[model samples]
Target: MLITKGYFYNRESHVNCQALKDAWVTLLSRYHWDWFCTFTFRGEILHPEKASKTFDTLLCKINRALFGR
Candidate 1:
């Protein structure tokens, strides 16, 4: 199985990474609004990569919950 931002896509399919990033941003904004806004609005919040990883984890968990192993 191929995983992108924790969402699995067929390896043969050309999945856009931007779509996964967008999904991550949406997921954070929707479920973690306070942190999302804080991190977004805060100046010098120098951990975007970390946040991206977190988003990936969240997406993975969500995917597992929705689709199972």
Candidate 2:
């Protein structure tokens, strides 16, 4: 069985993307399964372009860790 959870933040909230990335990587590393899973995040980013870059980096890291690319 696979379990998935999502976290959302409002526009006025202050979010540390690096901290979030670290937490997610740690969680993924700790409890990863062979079955495919998806992670969806919904929140307000103060800088969409910057956040996009960060998320892209996060995705690459995740793929490399999970798939050994």
Candidate 3:
């Protein structure tokens, strides 16, 4: 999937598999955060996690992992 702070992503986690296979989407921009960076795709946020994430939050977690908290 993708990570970003864009406020337009509203897909499911499992859908990424198909979304990738279909080539209907691709990582776009990156909302730079203190820790991680957000990845945007097709003007949408690509969090798609089971937890309550709004693309922005997912980006935070990604930051924590990649850049550390």
Candidate 4:
């Protein structure tokens, strides 16, 4: 929801590794915003090199959810 809401992708916003971690921390602490980190994020939006193993797992899950395989 964050990306669609225009939060994480803004060039004005610092969405680097450390900044992302901190934002997740804040969202976890706040509770309501957890969906931004967990659900709203799309690994396919990241470059291939930047997609981690975890993202691979998520991508597989997304594929399964969409394709029913």
Evaluated against the true structure, the overall lDDT of model 2 is 0.69
**Candidate 2 Cα deviation (angstroms), residue 26:** 32
- Which residue pairs in candidate 1 collide? none
Candidate 1 Cα deviation (angstroms), residue 63: 0.3
lDDT of model 2, residue 2: 24
Report how far residue 7 has shifted in candidate 2, in Å. Answer: 22
> Model 3 RMSD to the real structure?
14.4
Off by over 4 Å in 3: 1-53
For model 2, residues 1-69, the per-residue Cα lDDT tens digits are: 222243335556544566678888898898858886464556854477776787789989989999997
Please list the C-alpha lDDT of all candidates, in the order they appear: 0.68, 0.69, 0.53, 0.63
Q: TM-score ranking from best to worst?
A: 1, 2, 4, 3
Local error of candidate 3 at residue 23 (angstroms): 16
Residue 54, model 4, lDDT: 60
Q: Per-residue lDDT for 1-69 in model 3, tens only?
A: 454443223465433445554453334233433655454457655556723456657769878999887
Comparing 2 and 3 by TM-score, which wins? 2
Best by TM-score: 1
TM-score of 4: 0.27
Q: How does each model score on TM-score?
A: 0.35, 0.34, 0.25, 0.27
TM-score, candidate 1, is 0.35
- Candidate 1's C-alpha runs over 4 A off are 1-46
TM-score, structure 3 vs. true: 0.25
Stretch of 10 with least lDDT, candidate 3: 24-33
